[model samples]
Target: MITDVEWATFVPSALLLAATPGANQLLTLRNGLRHGLAPAVSASLGRFSAFALMVIAVAAGLGAVLAASEVAFNVIKWCGVAYLLWLGARTVLAAVRGQVAGEMQKTADEGDGKGVRGGLSSWRLGWQEFLVAATNPKALILFAVFLPQFLPRGAKDVAVPLLVLGAAYIRIEFCCACGYAALGSRLQSMGISLRARRWLDALTGVAMLGLAGWLATENH
Candidate 1:
């Protein structure tokens, strides 16, 4: 069991870590702004669900393997970096094309003549969001590396300590995510012109690209 003192100490750091906001945070924000709050929130849930699973898996076994193999870590790390860059490029392209591209996508989807599937579809959209949250490599690494730091030496069971830490981390993460989603959803209603939207997308894309480059250049 984590002492109250330890929990207090750990929670602040965990919250700070979560507050940094990365690709996943931006993705959730974009989705909320573009598709609406429900869909964005759904994605957040998927992401967190995956994150929880990764923490549990790492605590159980994956952490040891990751800790042991430098080569494996490097490989995964590079892959994650490359993926970030790819996503950044796509965001940039979307911004370059502006609202025409966004509207075109909507038009094409509507042309398919598929009727709205209602609330269930919204939930499914949320699941998609959740899955993205769950699968991000950065989130995986954070759990594997960050949560274990506060574990007491000679803890009776490693898993229990990991769980406590994981729960603390997730609590902060969800709060931050919800806050972002709410804010983005609000801004989405204010209605930007296509030109302004393009600029916003461009800025976000540049930020993502810079972040990706930083991640790629980081030493393990």
Candidate 2:
């Protein structure tokens, strides 16, 4: 069990880590700003789901295997880079062509569409968020490497400790996501213009590109 002292240290650190602006947070923010709170919140479930899987993987010791294998790590890293690059490029192109109005209309239509189309849109959003969270090697590293430091001294079996820490992190992250979603949803009432929307997309694209570049430089 984690000590009260440990909890004291961990909570603040966890909050800081969860609040750090990363690709996942950026995605949530964009989703919130673009699609409104409900859809964005729904989409963020994908991210949380991915984190849950990773925590389970860590507890199961797969995280250690992934951490140790350079080949495996590199494979996942490259895939992330590729996906971020492709996604970022698409958004950048849309912004460059001044297609925000058409793109937003299409997204709104898909999000608001009935039955199959709406389901597909929700699934796609969730899947995208999932991929972004899952593909990042840093997440696994968080479990395999960073998390163990918080474990009880001389503790042999790490599963429970990992799960505890993972749960706390996920909980904090969800709160942060909701906060971001609410802020973005508020913009809906303010009636942001298409030009501003284009700039936002462009900004997000550039940030994604930066994150891809950063991920490409990560080492085991």
lDDT of 2 by residue, 90-160 (tens): 87888889876565655555552221236888899889999999999888878677677777688877788
Candidate 1: residue 123 lDDT (0-100)? 67
Task: Give lDDT: candidate 2, residue 22.
Answer: 84
Clashing pairs in 1: 42-126, 43-129, 43-130, 45-130, 46-130, 46-131, 47-130, 47-133, 47-134, 50-134
Whole-model Cα lDDT of every candidate shown, in order:
0.67, 0.80
Worst 10 residues of 1 by lDDT: 107-116
- The ten-residue window of minimal lDDT in model 2 covers 108-117
Among these predictions, the greatest lDDT belongs to 2
Give candidate 2's error at residue 9 in angstroms. Answer: 0.9
